[model samples]
Target: MTTEQSWWRRNRWPVLALAVLLPGTVILTTSSEWFDYQNGLYSHAVTVPDGQSAVYGGAEFRVDDTVLVRGGTEGGDELELDPDMDLIVAVLEVTPGKDLVDSCNLTISATSPAHPEKRTWNANVDLPRKFPPTGDSQTTCSDSQGEPYRLVVAATVPSGAAETSSWVQIEKIGLTPNYLELELSPSAVSSASTSSDISSSSTSAVRRDDLRQKSNATASRLTRTGSTIRSITNPIG
Candidate 1:
C-alpha cells in the first residue's frame, strides 16, 4: 500500500532467512566451547604441589625448587636486574611427550596488600642441554629412559613484591593450556626475606660478590652443555 510496505514485502524473504540462520550460526559457533566446558576441560585449575609432577598435553612438568637472587647469568652472560628489581628463579624438570617443546612460557606476578599494585614479569627460560640429545643418549619422548631436562626460569620484579603474596602463578605455553599456582611456602618466603636483609645490611657487598661468582659458575656450566636460553614476551593480562 505504501513505499515502506513495498520495501518490506520485497525484503521479507531475506529477513526471514537471516532470522532463521542467525540462531543456528550462534549455536554452531558456541557448541565446541560448551562441549569443552561440560567435559571438564574449562573447569578447575590443576594445583600441583611443590616438588611434584603434573602431566599436561602428554608432557611431564615438575617444579623442583625456587630461589630469590639479585640477578643471574645466562649463556655465559650476566643478566642483571634493575636496582629496584629482584629475580625469582624456579627450577623445572621437563620430559617431552609427543611434541618436542622448543620453548616454554610463563608469567610471575607479585601481590601486596599495602602496595595494591601487582608486580608481574615474564620468565626467561634457560634449558640445560640441547634437546633431542645426539648419539646413544637419544630417546623418544615416551621412552622410560628418556632423559629429563632441567630448565631455569627467571622473573625480575620489585624487590619486596613477593613478600605480600603467598602464591605465584605460572602458565605453560601452547594451545592445551596448563597453570601452576605455586605456593610460596613459609620457608621460601623466609629465605627470600633473609636474602633481602643480607642485601640491605652492611654485608650486602660481600653477598653480591658471592652471588656474582655463583651466577658465573652456573653460566659456564650451561654454556659448555649447549644449553638454550630464550626470553619470551609477557602475557596480556
Candidate 2:
C-alpha cells in the first residue's frame, strides 16, 4: 500500500473510537450539569433560626413564635381536641414586596427527628381569627405600605410530637419554590407542653373565651385598616 493509505489504515480505528466516546462523554456531562442547574433553579430550602427573619421570593418571612395548644379552634370558634391530637400554632409576620401573595399558599409543617413522618397544615391567614367569615373570603399578602401583617398558622399533631430536633417548615408558593426550615427550640417546646397540659383540662373554657375576645378585637382592627380577610379556593395539601 502507499504511504498515505498506510497512515489512514493505522489511525482509522483510534479515530473512530474517539468520535464515538467523545460525544457520549459530552452528552453525559452536559446532562448532569443541566440537572443540577434545574434543581437549584426550581426549588431552594433555607434553614432559619426560630424567631428570626428570612426573605424568600421577594417576601419577608419572620417566625415570631410557636405555640402548642392542647385544643383547636375553627372559624373563630374554639373546639375541644381529641385526646390524642394537639394543636401546633406558629405565629408569623410577612411583609409583601411589590407582589401579591396568595395567603392560601402559605403553609406550615412539623417534622420530628424521632419520627420520620411529617405533619403539615394550611395556614389561617385571617388571624387572630381562626377562619374566614365566608367561603369566598381570603387573606392575601398585598403591599401593606411598609406595614407588616401578622399570620397565625396552626396544625393539629399528636401530643408529645413537639420535641427537640423537631423543625417547622414554611413554604411560600409561587413559580419558584422556596421553603423556610425553622428549628423548633427545646425551651419553646417544653414550655408549650407544660402550659398546654395544664390549660388542656381545667382552664380550657376560660382560655377559649379569652381567645375569642382577642380574635374579635383583631378582626375589628383589620377591618378598620382595610386589610383583606377574604377566603380563597386554595386547599391545603
Candidate 3:
C-alpha cells in the first residue's frame, strides 16, 4: 500500500465504529420513508451554529403567506398547516467552520398534517455532552396526520446566558426530518374499484348519495399545505 493508504489503514480503527455506524444509519433513513403520487413531500435545510447568536430567516408557508423570525421572537408562535397533508422534514446544519464553544440550540414546532386546527408539537435538541464531537442535533419528523396539512419547525437560541445553557450560539442548523408519508385506507382511494357486475335495475336501487360519493371520488385531485413557519425555534416549542 502507498504511504497515505498504509497510515489510514493503521489508525482508522480508533474512530471506525463511528465511521461505519454513521453511513449505515444514513442509508437506513432514506428507504424508511416513502413518497407516493397523491401525497406531496416538503422539506427545508438551514444552518445554525453552536454558541453564536443566530439570526432567523423567515419561512414561507403553504398558505401563501410569509412570516418573519429573528433572535428574540419567543413565546412559541402559532402556525396553521393544511389538512389532508402527510409529511414535514426540518433539516439543520451543525457543522461549524470554526470550533464552537457550546452546542447549537435547535428546536422544532409541528402540527397535524391531515387535520388542521390541532395543537402543535414543540420539541428541542437535547445535547449529549459530547455534541460537536459525537453527532449532530437534528429534528427528523417521522409521523403526520393528513388532517391539518402542515408542519412547522422553529429554531431559536435559549433564553438564558450564552454560556449557561449547553445549547446556545447555533452557527448552522442541519435540518433532516422524517417523512409524513400517507397510508390511505382502501375506502379512501379505491372505493370505486370495489364495484362488481351490476345491472340497470341496480342503478335505480342505489341511493343518490352513493352516486354523489362516486362523482366526488372519481376524477379528483387535491392540494393542501400549512401556515408559514415564523422562526425556527418559536414555531415549535
Instruction: Report lDDT per candidate.
Output: 0.46, 0.49, 0.24
What are the per-residue Cα lDDT tens digits for candidate 2 across 1-237?
655567768899998999999998999889988766765553555766554566655566655444555543231135445556556554456666555555435455565666657665555532222322322112344434555665545555666665544455655554344466655544545655555443332123223423323333432221112232232212221
TM-score of each prediction: 0.48, 0.56, 0.17
lDDT for each residue of candidate 3 in 14-47, tens digit (9 for 90 to 100): 6798799899898777655553321232242233
Candidate 3 deviant stretches above 4 angstroms? 1-87, 99-101, 110-120, 124-237
Q: What CA root-mean-square deviation does each model show from the true structure?
A: 12.4, 10.2, 24.2
RMSD, candidate 2, Å = 10.2
Clashes of 1: 0
Which candidate achieves the best lDDT against the true structure? 2
- Candidate 2 stretches with Cα past 4 Å from truth are 1-43, 71-78, 117-119, 124-146, 165-168, 195-237
Q: Could you say which candidate leads in TM-score?
A: 2
